[model samples]
Target chain A: MRLPSLIREVWANLLKKPATVKYPFEKLPLSKTYRGKHELMRDRCVGCGLCAKICPAFAITMRSVYGKVSPEVDLAKCIFCYQCEDVCPRGAIKRGKEYELASWSRNEMIVR
Target chain B: MEALRKAEENFVVLKAFNDLVLDVVSKDLCTKCGMCVSSCQVHAISMTDEGPKSVGPCRQCEACYYGCPRSPATSEELLKASLSSEKKDDILGSYNKIVSARTVLSEVKSVAQDGGVVTTLLIYALEEGLIDGGIVASKSTIEAWKPVPKVALSINDVLEAAGTKYSNCPSLVALKDALYGYDLSKVCVVGVPCQVTAARNVKVQPKAARKIGDKIAFIIGLFCMESFPHVKLAQFLTSNGIDIAKVSKFDIKEGKFRVYMGDAEVLSVPIRNLKDYANRFCETCRDLTSWYADVSVGAIGSGRDWSTVIVRSDEGAKLFDGAVQNGYLEVKDIESDGIESLRKIAKRKASKN
Candidate 1:
């Protein structure tokens, strides 16, 4: 709309670094609290299931883990609210900062 | 005392066993304790996911209905007849002594919920020829976790039914089988509080517990707060990651529900969270100790590995004393605090309804 402002914006872009990263070659910077694919510490999971009870997405299914039952998370349905990690008394689940999770199959996304 | 005889001497025949299914079972008053299923002489009733269902044609006999532990008609009679002491104890119905005891045998203690006193006593009874075979609630052969009633003749049979099952078992079905199929004239019956009442009914209310008649020679009752449904308990274990098929024992202690697969602990849950998985019928039950039983053995007020046995009647005392004297069990009197603990527990259970 304005010739001077348009020229100024182009001049600013030429000197500035790109906002996006070359994801495969270079890792992206993630916040400490960033929610990503979950990680389950099986040793810490006492199978109390408070997370399963409170999960709003209904993505978690309690599956038999050895002699006891533990939750199996479907990453496809997880909204990354980190509610599961928050409710876990044992701190068995955590939302990690690693977000480069591109799977070939939906079945691969299910963490048992 | 006069009212006791007058109240119980004339045992009235109810309309039908279906009346119990309608009035008690269908009304959600059924504890699913298996007294009716075990006591039914005819193959008229069977247990289902919805609870006991009337299957075959009715013969108009009220054995199943009358023998139901939760029914008012039988409950009233059982209460009067079972409480034959000079005065009610308010906590324990009728008792001669309260003691903490354990079966001395290693085989019993290995798989026991506590002292294995009940199993030891049953073994003693079988060996002493006091009983031909007894009806006991145990895990089903088909389904590992589901409870089933069986006629136990040998010590091994008794041991098979040893540990406490949180699920309600239809024990009376086996009692009927014991009387009819096995033709056992004298038999001991082990069950929870309500079940022993139903067993006593076979003695007092002849028309109701008519399937077994007066065949029950001795009764061993367990202390119970409540029992659970089979499906609910399985769901609970699955939710907790307990493989029911691998479970070797089930126990409730120190407000924790534990499932054991051999010596290895499978899963454990605090008892408070277990309420949702419980049988609806057990919620209405007020008997913690089988008040009407000959001997009530439970782990409530005892030491870590001992069971508190309440010796109620002369026959109950006889069996318990016989077991101890013959080296089947090691006995020690309960402490005042232990007795007080039992009293408080029983009082709390009675107040639930």
Candidate 2:
């Protein structure tokens, strides 16, 4: 291609609409595999504690009373690395895409 | 000057005008379902009639779709057949006959996770020289699922393992460790059905079969439908504004976890939400009672504060009988209706994938 034509194409491209999503303003559709927020179904939780054991970050904790299972996670310590979601054989702790996680204070970062 | 001005106009003005025109003409595909409205964690997303509109320019955060169940739903609900069968009287009698001869409830219930029957029984075995150590779930820290196969030497340790952990715990690997790593001659391990089966499969720890693996003197199985992922439980507590640090108690009853925040019933979370976090492995499981275990301990069809224990082997019956004889346990022959309920529950759970 000629240099003049290439430069013209480049200029035209620059003037065209950018492919970047406005993000929060213009949200991008999440990919099918995007891992984001963690959700727990209370009734189904048998408190077996496999999720915490497999978590490399050790961010999860199991709580209980009268022998029932209860678990908690600290989002501040989480790296958003979805290892916990993958090893969960029950698919209990799944990744959700709501990724806006900024906070004015350190406490806000603490999920649990 | 005019030529320079024209050149400047050519570079910036035309492009800016074109962008504005394109922006206005473009079709906004945002569906104003208010799904994003409820999904946003920071109130960042709002819906307008003219397609879901964004108010403040987004901070590039994508919290809207992550927690939304409708936006590319991550899970599927399917119909499946059950895998369990009724517990035969012969099987029950055999197990009771064995456990009742060997152990007591005082030792089991005092230190166990919930009712303490399992732990107490295990302790009696260890103390009575029936076994070396009781392999049970032991809490390493307050923040993680209790690791299974933790050998408890004292009554306190046994009590720690007595509770019901409805979440899928990998501590079942402790069985593998017991057979391979620890040179135990006889080990009393507690687990779910899968772990019991795995333990029974091992004949020798090494390839040469040089070291005979430990015999599972007692296999106390917990009844489980499915276990939740630990992270989901934690997130639910926090999202509901419950202080995790201050949480003193957590109970699952009537399909709800009545979370107590400093002695106050702050939240009653539906058990269905907790079910969403269950481990996927449970779907394929067919045995509600570890059929191979010496005895299974769970609350599937029992009244509160009592565990429905199904003794499967002779060894289990002996221990249970012994515990009762020694006045350490209180035994009420399970009613026929209760037994039927348990069987129904087991059959249903076994079939669900």
| Candidate that would win on DockQ | 2
Error of 1 at B338 (Å): 0.4
Over 4 Å off in model 2, which ranges?
A1-112, B1-114, B142-149, B175-182, B203-214, B257-265
Put down candidate 1 lDDT per residue, B1-353, tens digits, no spaces.
99888868654444576688778877888766666665554466777667688787655545666567777677564555664444357677778888899989999988777888988999999999999998888778899778788999888888888878877777867876786678687999898887888778766664464425456889899898878887887888888777778888788877788787878877777887888888777777788888888889999988888999988888898899999999999998887799888888788878867
Interface RMSD of each: 23.3, 19.4
Model 2 lDDT per residue over B7-45, tens place: 777552221112211332132322222333322222343
| TM-score for each candidate, following the candidate numbering | 0.69, 0.50
Residue B147 in candidate 1, Cα distance off native in Å: 2.1
Candidate 1 residue pairs in backbone clash: A68-B241, A69-B240, A69-B241, B34-B170, B34-B171, B37-B173, B38-B172, B38-B173, B39-B172, B39-B173
Model 2 TM-score on a 0 to 1 scale: 0.50
How high is the CA lDDT of each candidate model?
0.78, 0.52
Output the number of the lDDT-best candidate.
Answer: 1
Worst-scoring 10-residue span by lDDT in model 1 chain B: B205-214
